[model samples]
Target: MTSLLRILRFAPQLNPLYLGIAVSSVLAALLSLATPFLIGAATDRIVDAVAGRTGVAEAVTAVTWLAVAFLAVEVAATAVVSVGGYWGDVMAARMRTVLSTRYFEHLLHLPQRYFDTALTGRITNRLNRSITELTQFLQFFANNAFTMLITTAAVLVITGFYWWPLAVLLAVVFPVYMWLTAKTSTKWQVWEGEKNTEVDVASGRFAEVVSQMAVVRAYNRQEHELAGFRERFTKTVGLTRTQSRFWHGMDAWRRLAMNVVFGLMYLIVFVRTAQGLFSVGDMVILLQLMNMARQPIFSMSYLVDSAQRAVAGSKDYFAVLEEERERAGGRALEAGEVRAVPNGPAEARADVVEGETVPLPADVPAVRFTDVTFAYDDDAARPVLDRVTFEAGVGEKIAFVGESGGGKSTITNLLMGLYPVGDGRIEVFGNDVAGLDLAAVRGSIATVFQEPFLFSGTVRENIAYADPDATDERVRAAAKAAYADSFVEGFDHGYEQIIGERGLRLSGGQKQRIAVARAVLKDAPILVLDEATSALDTRSERLVQAALEELMVGRTSLIVAHRLSTIASVDRIVTLRAGRVEEIGTPAELSRSGGIYAQLLQLQQAGTKEAKRMLKEYGIHG
Candidate 1:
């Protein structure tokens, strides 16, 4: 119930039109109340005419007038209903648009970990179902539920006028029904929660399998994936059956209770008619009123159940909405200048590389991590980065080199402020990153990942993503700088060629170069290449590495490099081992020290040779 109220706070309002809808609803309901009386009177008049107690002409006239009046009222009620329904739909559409957009904006602010760990289908299911269910509930409450209440209230009023005792009986019967319903609805809520969870699991499993179609085929696990999906499907079917049966069981019990009361009311009215205390017309009204009341009573379980489901769905939606967003900070960023806090002087550092340690010049480094430590999970035994510290002076190029799981990539994630850091401060321009406005901090840097992702758009559109309002000439210049202009111009449509999803239509070299072009266009003070050329072939890697060099020239650059060419000219190489920094020095300096950095470099050289030998055997290399 609380969740339902919370969801309704987003409900669209018709403002002054609500009064019109209400007036129309009340007028329609009142017109309906006239039915029982007019019907009863017409029946009595025919009886009176047949017995010669009333004149034939007068009886016909009275009956004709009554019919005309009923017709007019019915026509008026229908018109009122049409207007009311139109506003109801308007409100429903507005609510759906507002709620869904709010959910989207909330997701934009969510931390990266949410996307990392949360199931795609579960989040989508919750988002989709909440909006759908809430919309239905709102429409039902505004129209059908409102109509049912007015009809019930009108019946109660007429029933009391016909006979006080029947009204009193109704008052007693429905209160008991409501009390039982309240208890049953509590149990239904529990079941409904479980049912929704099962649905999300089934939805997520289907999505996961479909999205990983290549992996399933490559691994020959089609049958295994099918079995997994079937298991979830079977569980959801069972839950659906249970939900259906529970609702019907409760509905049947309530119907029986309502019918029993109705039967008793019939007997009471029959006795009164026999005693000559009431006319046949009065008995007609009594039965008509009870029938009207019966309809709402029959629909009670459905309305109550919908309310419960809406409440549960709203809670699911809010669960995501209520999560904490990236914390905001006080620092402002300028377009050309980047703020990077340098680590304390490398004095007393165990991981110091053997060479004269150069303190990053104090012009406020473009990027800095000082004793920064963090673990992806609190229960993780060892943090991913332990007391890791580094700094890049303005326009200085630094590279992180290590084997996988040694935390080379974690540095980029931290610098981008994608995750929260707890142990130490990361400074951008001397301001603690934790205290700097994240939007401004992120806006100050550009990143190109090993897997270059492209949206489904034209070649020109992809480049312009860095600055949507960039001029055509500006975009072309950026592309040329990354060495992508030649390949792009070769396309049949030139820059207008539509790239397939994630640039699947482009070669590895082409995609990486376009990604670099985007970074070039962004022209931020800082650039990060996280294994950006590692996945390419020799030719592609050479092209992409060359493109990266042009992009990094005037920016503070951080590279998590896998190739010797990428590290050869870096100002400093920071070596990581088991989540701690092993050394920081020039690539030449580290190679001479014969430490962890030198050993990893040697292994990579061997792998490169083996790869070349394999390529030569395949006639692709000399």
Candidate 2:
């Protein structure tokens, strides 16, 4: 119920439409009440003619006009109802769009930990089901509730003509119906919430299996997966059945109670007529009024059911909407002129390379972290990164190497402002990252992850993703620099060849090259390579690495390397252990110091030797 109220607060623009619908509903109810009176009048005329108090021909003519007027009222009422329905649909669509858009924007601003703790399917279910339920609640349930109110009032007015007994009977019966409906609706809502949870779990499981189909097939876990899905499905079906049966039983009881009351009302009217308390036409009008009252009572019960469902669905939706977005408060990164550095072969002198470095303005460090700390949850069982303080000078190439959980990715996320700092601060280019515009912060850096992500598009489009407005010459130049042009040109479609989902149509090397091309096209001052060449073969790695060296010439580069050989030539390495920086020095200094870096180097050499030995054992070597 609280959730439903929150969602309804999004539509201040729909108030006028709701007002119009309400007015139409009241008018329709008045027309419905008049219908029985018209019928009663026609009946009274017949009774008069039988008594010889009036002529039959005049009554017949009056009946024809009354019939036409009734038909017109019915048609007009339906038109009003139709207009109300159409307006409701439009309002629902706009509200759904507003809520959905807010949800997406909020998600974009959420911290990395939020995503780690939340499932994609659960979020998707809440967004979809909430909007759908909210729309129906406004369109049908809300309108019905209002219509029922007006109809009840109209019925009371008409009942006054017959006798006060019928009105008293309705007064007693309506409360009982409402009480039963409320009780049944409460149980139904709980069951519906449970059913939605089961649905989310089942959907998440299906998504997981489909995403990892290769692994599932490899382990022959098809039957196991099927059994898991069936268990969730059975639970959902069972709950749905239980809820349906209870509501159906409640509906049957309500109908029985209503029929009993209706029968009693007719008996009273008939007895009164026999006793000369009322004429036949009056009894007829009493019966008609009783039937009219039943319409709202029956409809109200269904409205209660719909309202409960909407409340349950809105609870899930608002839960997501109410979640806090990533904090933003700091200074914006000042964009400076990018001086083009001279590109040359790998053998260029160190002094020349140092001279080519682009100078950052005095206000900005290439990167800065002050007393930073981060935890996935507030409980603080373990911190992902703790008191991590570091600063990188402009145009410096810094590499981070450590075990898998050493917080390398977490650091990158913080730098990109994807997560808020738990303690202290993070600044990029002199501006506190938290205070800067997220899109602007992200736009200032170009990243190439270990596994490149490519949407379904032509090679040219994929490369141009970094800068959508990049010219053809710029795209070709970046591709050529990344060594992607040679192979791309060989394809019949050349740059226009469409890649399949996630670039599955391309080999690992080809995809990496294209990703590299994209980053190069962006030409941001900061470049982050997270195991960028980890997926490529040695030959491809050599070619891509050469291209990367050119790209990294004067830019500030942060490299996360798995292979020791990849960062051997880098200026400095920061070794992390258990979410803390353990070592920071030149590659040679760390290699000779016999620390984690030395151990990694030894492992890499041993692995290389083992690979060679395996080739020799197979009698297939260069």
Candidate 3:
């Protein structure tokens, strides 16, 4: 009930519409009171006429009129109820849109850790359930609950008009009934909360298994997974059974209370009639009104249940919204800087400034890291990157060579502002990346990773991900440059081929090429190749390397070096050892220096020549 009241606190914004709903509800309630009076009067006349106390013709006439009046009252009540429902729906829809959209928008901006750590099914289940209950609870409160209150009050007042004692007796009993219900219902509220959490857990497990069915089958763990699911399912069933039995017990007591109240009201009516103070028709009306009170009386308890469900659902929904949003305190991206230009591509809008758009100067490095230090977690003893400083000026291709934990990829993550820096600065075009919109900072750089992830869409759509509005000519050109055009054209649908989820339908080499095409299509000033061509056959590597060379011609590129031979043509190579700069020089200079770079190069060229020999037999080069 507290949650119910708290949610209704949002009703002030819908005052005018809510006020209309209120008026309509009252009208319906007042009209409902007409039923008992009209029927009671008609019943009296029909009885008298049948007994010859009144002429048959006159009684028939009177009864016909009463029936007509009753019909009219019902019609009017129905019309008023319809109008109330309309306004209730409008308010409900508005609230749903505001709350869910805001919730989803919060999800969109939440820090990366939320997505990485949260369960997909749990998030979705909470989102969906919360929305459903919130809408139901709110809509019922706005119209149905209001109407019930009015009907209850109108019945009491009409009873008082005929007999004040009856109304007073009700006023006292109603509060006690409500109070008892609240106390008992408090316990069931915990049941609803427990059920919701268990559902989330079950949903999460089911979702994970469904998404990873292949792994489950390969590992032959179906029985193991089923045992876990059965455990959760049994717990849910036990909780549900206990909650239902308790409610059923409470229901028996509720019926006893209702019967007692009905009998008391009947006894008082009979006493008044015996005292010659009330007519039989008056007694009939009191009985009719008492019967009408049943729905609203039970409804009060039901609504309390609904309110509890709403409260529980709201907790889950707000938990998601309460997560920290990404820090976006930076200048907005300039028009034509990252996203596609409004009218056309960048080539078409070379000097066309549509509005107050700022362009980066031509001479500044595409990106620069100055004494940057970072850790994924703040309390960690060792940082991923410590005082890592480097610069990639315009069109200068630089590569970072390191062991697995040497923080090569972390540099790119820092530059992209995916994580907050523990200390120091990263700049894009001389402006602190922190002081520029993170989206814009990311937009200015096109990245291709080792494991390219392509969504389940057509080849054209995947390639045009960087610029959804790209023309067919642009898509084909980018694909051709990345050597993806040959295979794509071979497909039955050509550019429209439906690649399966994560591009699983395509070979690894094919997926990487499409990724390269996507980056090429963006034509951003900065390019990031994070082991982009690693794990490919020599034949595929050569093709991808050629495409990489084409894409790097004008943009400043940062290459996370995976192999020694590939990066020999780069402007400079920075060797990182255990998260610190160990050496920095040209490939030729490093090879001649007899240091870490020289040792790494010698070690790589020493791999048993058999694998390389077989690869060379198939016209492959590495």
Candidate 4:
């Protein structure tokens, strides 16, 4: 109940309407009490007429007007309830929209480390479940709570008129009812929270397996994957069943107790009527009022369950809401004229700026990592980037060559401001990357990841994502530069061809080229090409590499390549070992020096026999 109050604080706009609903529901319950009294009065008047009492005609007239007024009040109460229902629906819709929108915005600003620890499907599930429960809470819980309160008050007040003892007895039981409700609801709340977590885990596992079905098939590990999924599913089912059973047991107990209490009330009412304490009409009114009180108790029990579910769902929702956003530091970058430095590397110069060594702007480095360190968990002793430092300057391409889990992509993420720096600072344009506007930083760079993502739109739209306002001429030129226009033109719809979700309709190379075209259109000063040509065939690779070279001419470029030959043309080669920079120098310099980069180059030049021997020694294979 306290949780419900706290959650309502997020949506204060609905408070007035909620108050109105409560007031109307109370009025309706009060009016409903009159029906019983009117019937009792009419019954007594008829009894007087039958007993030869004086002024029977006036009594009959008064009874008729009382009955008419009772009917009118009942009709008005029904109208108010109907209007309250409509308002409840409207409030639910508005809350769903506002909370869902805020949730999305929060997701957009959260640090990349959050995603590193969280699963995409799980985050999505939490968002969906939270909004759904929140809507239900607003629509049903608020109105029902008000109805329960009014019903309880009406029952007590009406009972006081005929017999104060019955009213006092009900008042005594109210606290017991509330306590039991709170205890059972607390247990259910904990169970519900666990159930929600299990559901998210199951969803995450299922989505991961489905998305990587190709890898499973290639390895012929279908049975193994199925076994793992089944295990996870079984655990989730067990948790769900446990949660359901507990709630069912609690509900059964509540119903049995309620029945016993109502039976006692009925017995007391009957005894009072038999003693001539009240007329038959008075007995009917007492029974009706008791029944009304029972309705709220039953409803309250049901509401406890609903409230538990909402609490569980809200925990997940607020987790997202409470996530830390990208630190803006209330600082905006100076919108000065950006100039291209001629006869220079187009990267920031490695010189002291305010007592800190900043990268060269003329070099226009694809990226610069300056003693950067990061960890998803604050308690983690080993950082993902352990004082890692390097620079890939303009017209100077660099490749990150290392074993998997060597923090290659972590460096890329830091450069992109997807994650915040924990130890040392990073700079891009003679400005602290931390202080730079994230949009402005990303706007100056383009990336083509290993797995290219495409929206559900036409090919033209996908390529033009880098620059939504790009002209047709610019789009066509970019496509040509990426060597994608020829193949696109060959297609039936050409630029208008629709690509399915994530470009699943297109082949790997086709998607890669389209991604390249999108990046080319942006024409950013820096480019990060992560396995851009790794998915291409030999012929496609040759053409794509040519296009990439053209795009890399004036901009700083960072390329992560799997094939050794693909990186031979890069100006510098940086070898990473366990999250730390092991070697950094030009390809020619490193190859002649016989370091980690040289050994890799030598292994690449060797035949299959030596290559296999090298892989056996280094524990790496093609």
Candidate 5:
């Protein structure tokens, strides 16, 4: 109930339309009350002529006037209801838009850790189910809530004027039926929640399997996945059956109670009229009013059902909204400044006027990491990074080389502020990362990941992702710089060719080159390449590596590589093992030092003669 009330808190902005619907519904209900009175008058007049108490001519004239009034009232009620219904439909659509946009905006602000734990499909399912149910209930309530209230009240008053006992009988049904329904509410909601869980999990798996259909077929796991999906839905069906049985069983009891009460009221009305205590006209009106009361009593049950579902839906929707949003500030960066971070004390440098270039000071780096430690799981005993300290000077091409899961990628992630730091400091462009604006930091840095993630759009769009407003000429130049222009030009539509989801339509090297071109267009002062060419074949790797070389020039680049030979030309190599830094030196120095770098080099040279020759050519003598 509280959750449903919280949903109403967002309705104030649409209060005028809400008020309009209420007023119209009330007016229609009032007009509709006139029908029974008009019919009752016509009936009495006809009875008088039949009993020879009045002339047929006078009776027919009275009945004709009443029939005309009844027609007018019915027409007016219909028109009022139509107008209210129109307002309700419009309000419901706008509410859907408001709720969906609010949910999406909050989703974008939630920290990365939220996405890491929640399934994408399940998150999407919650939004769809919750918003759909809520808006439906809201629209129904707006159209019928006031009408039901006014209609039931008028029936009670009109019936009581004729017979108080009938009013008492009608009133008793409400509390008894409500109590019966209330007794099952807690259990009903519990079942609803369980069914929702089953549905969400099954839907999540459905989406996952669809996206990875190639892998499922490759491994011949289609039957296995289908069996899992069916098992979940089977559980959902069983739960739904049980729930329906309970609800309908209670409904049967409620209807029986209503029927018995109405029968007594009807018997009383007939007996009292025969004893001359009530006239035929009075009896007719009383019975019709009682029938009207029956409608609202039945409608109450439906309203309760809708309210219950709405409460459940609002609970799920607001739960996500209550989550902590990311507090990272939005700050833009200045262009053409060589900010420095000193290893020891601060060094004095000349300050220049606005937009003037400053020379980078000696022994000062563009980026610095000091004793940084982090772990994905807070309860885990071993952290992913342990007191890792490193530096990348301005315009220096530094590479990190290590085996799998050696925290090489973790360093890059930390530098990008993708995860919160556990201990120690990280500085980008002489500013501590924790205190600096995240947007400004990210603005100066560009990253190319191992597997390029591109949206399903044109090749030109993918290249311009780094700068959405970039001109066609600028896009072409960046593509040319990355050596992707040749292949792109060969496509049927050239730059306008549609790349499928995650660049599925493009070859592996083609995807990587487009990613490289995006970074090239960004032209940031700092570049981070995380195994960019590791997933390609020899020819593709050569092409991608050549493009990467062109993109990395004159920038502070950090390369995370598994292939030893690929990073041989870097200014320096930082070797890591088991979350700890093992060695830091130039490729030539580390090759002769017999550290992790030398061991990996030896392993590479132990392969084919061509591999050995490649290692030797990269200045590795093992």
Candidate 6:
């Protein structure tokens, strides 16, 4: 119930629509109350005519008027119900929109680590399940809740007027049935939660298998994956069977209780009519009201069913929404407040405006990592980077060469603020990264990763991702610089060519070049190439390396490379071993220093089997 209330709070603008539905529902229900009375009056008129107690013409006239009034009331009620239904449908749609939008926005603000540890499909599955149940319940309640209450109230009042005992019998059934249903609430919800877990895991795995179908086929594990998927859903089926039996078992008892009370009411009404204590018309009206009361009474079970599912679904939804959002950039200060820039002159105090770019001081290095340390979120895991320190001067190109898991990529990830450093500081252009606006810090850098991820969109769309508003000419120029323009022009649609998911339709080189083109289009002051060309063939490597060289000029470039040839032209090389910096020097100086870098360089130059063994021993890739 609390979760349902929280869901409603997500869309306050729908309040007026909800109120309108309630109003229409009440009007419809009140007008419907005239139905039984009109029918009873007509029945009494016929009885009088047949018994010769009233003149035929007068009896016919009364019956005719009663029919007309009943028709008018039914028409009005229908119109009111139609309006309420329309408003309910509209509100439900808008509720879904608001919920989905807010959930997606929340995800965008979550920390990167959240994505690392969570499955893509599981996250989306929660959103779909939660919003679907909430929207449905909201729509159902809007259309039926007020009408049910009003009808039930009218039944109580009318029954009391005819005979107070009949009202007592009808009212007693409601609480008794409700109490019986409440007994199963805890157990029902427990089963629902357990079923949801199996469903979510299956959904997550389903998405993962689909996305990696190529790998599955390559390894001939299609049967294995299918078995796993089936096993998960099979468990859900077993749970549903047990859950259904319990719910319906309780519902059977509730229905039996209601039927027994209704039978007693009927006997009392019949006995009174025969005893001359009430007219046949009075008996008719009482029975008709009882039937009306039954509708809402039966509907109680359905509403409870929906409410339980809604509560359970919303529990998961609210849990995600309640998580602490990733920290954002600092707000702009007042005019008199001082904004300190670390490593800046102590005498200098400045006012910082929100969302405005402030240039770095000229003398500050483009990038700096001072005694930085980090580890993944595992108790047994060692630090990936331990007190690693390095700096890149403005417009200088530095390369990091190391064995696998030697912290080469970790350095760039820290500089980009993807993960928090455990100790020490990372400064981007002389500002402590911890306090600087993350958007501003990341805006000045562009990265080309080893695995280029492209959406299923047009080439133009992917390239313009860096700057959505960039003109066609700028996009083409960037593509040309990355040597992708020629191949793009060869396509049937030129720049408008549709690139399949992750550019699956294109070759590896083509995909890498497209990624390079995106980075070129960004044109940030700092560039990061994390094994960007390592996966390409010889010819593709040359082409991409050339494009990278063109992109690196006049910018501060951070290069993590396995092939020594790629770093031969870098201004300096930083060699790492076992999460620590082993050596840092110019390419020529490191080549002769007999350090890790020199040994790897010497081994790479030799193509013999012994050289390969030595390289493998160091876990270095040639």
TM-score of each: 0.89, 0.87, 0.87, 0.84, 0.89, 0.94
**1-622: candidate 1 lDDT, tens digit per residue:** 7776666665446455445656667777777788888889988898789989999999999999999988988898888788888877877787788789888877877789889998888888898998898888877677666677788877877788878899988877777887778877776777778878877987887788777777889999988877876787687678778877876787788778888888999999999999988888888977888887887776777677777778888889888878876555533232222333224344533322212112333579878899989899999999999999888888899988765677778889988889888699887766677765566667777999988889889999999887888899999999999899999999999999999877878998999999999989887878899889867888988787788888888888998776665677999988887888889999889988997657655655667877555433322222
Q: Write one digit per residue (lDDT tens) for candidate 5, span 1-622.
A: 7776677776578888889999999998899788789988988999999999999999999999998899999899989999999999999998898888888978875767888988888899999999999999999999998988899888888887877877777777778878888887888888888888998899889888988999999999999999999999999899989988998788888888888998889899999999999889888888888888888888877888887788788888988888876543322222222333223235653332222221334567888999998999999889988999989999999998765677888898888777778898998767777765454566678899999988899999999987888899999999999999999999999999999988999999999999999999888888999989878888988888998888888999999864666678899999887788889999999999998778667768578777666544333322
Best lDDT among the predictions, by candidate number: 6
lDDT of model 5 at position 336: 22
By summed lDDT, the worst window of 10 consecutive residues in model 5 runs over 349-358
Q: Between 2 and 5, whose TM-score is larger?
A: 5
Better of 1 and 5 by lDDT: 5
Q: Which ranges in model 6 have alpha carbons more than 4 Å from their true place?
A: 330-358, 613-621
**lDDT of model 3, residue 245:** 82
Query: Over all chains combined, what TM-score does candidate 4 have?
Result: 0.84
Measured on C-alpha atoms, candidate 6 has an lDDT of 0.86
lDDT of each: 0.79, 0.78, 0.80, 0.76, 0.83, 0.86
- Of 2 and 5, the candidate ahead on lDDT is 5
Cα error, residue 500 of model 5, in Å, equals 2.1
2 against 3, candidate with superior lDDT: 3
lDDT of 4 by residue, 1-622 (tens): 5656766776788788778777766776676667777777777777777778748788879788988887898898788778878777887887788788778877876776688789888988888888898789768865667777877987897798778988987886677776777877776777677777777877787778777778889999889867876776777678768877876787778778778877888998898889988777788878888887878877776676677788788888877777666654323212121322212354852222111222346735546678888886788778777898887666668888776667777777778878778888776765677765566567677888877788879899999998788899999999999989988998899999988877878877788888889989988878888877766787887788788888888877887776666667888888887778889888778888877777876676675787867644433334
How far residue 67's Cα lies from its native spot in candidate 5, in Å, is: 2.1
Worst 10 residues of 4 by lDDT: 349-358
RMSD of each: 7.5, 7.8, 5.6, 6.4, 6.2, 4.0
TM-score (C-alpha, index-matched) for candidate 2: 0.87
lDDT of 2 by residue, 555-588 (tens): 8888876566667878888877777778888999
Scored by TM-score, the top model is 6
CA deviation > 4 Å runs, candidate 3? 1-23, 47-53, 86-97, 251-255, 330-358, 592-595, 608-622
Instruction: Please give the ranking of all candidate structures by lDDT, highest first, separated by commas.
Output: 6, 5, 3, 1, 2, 4
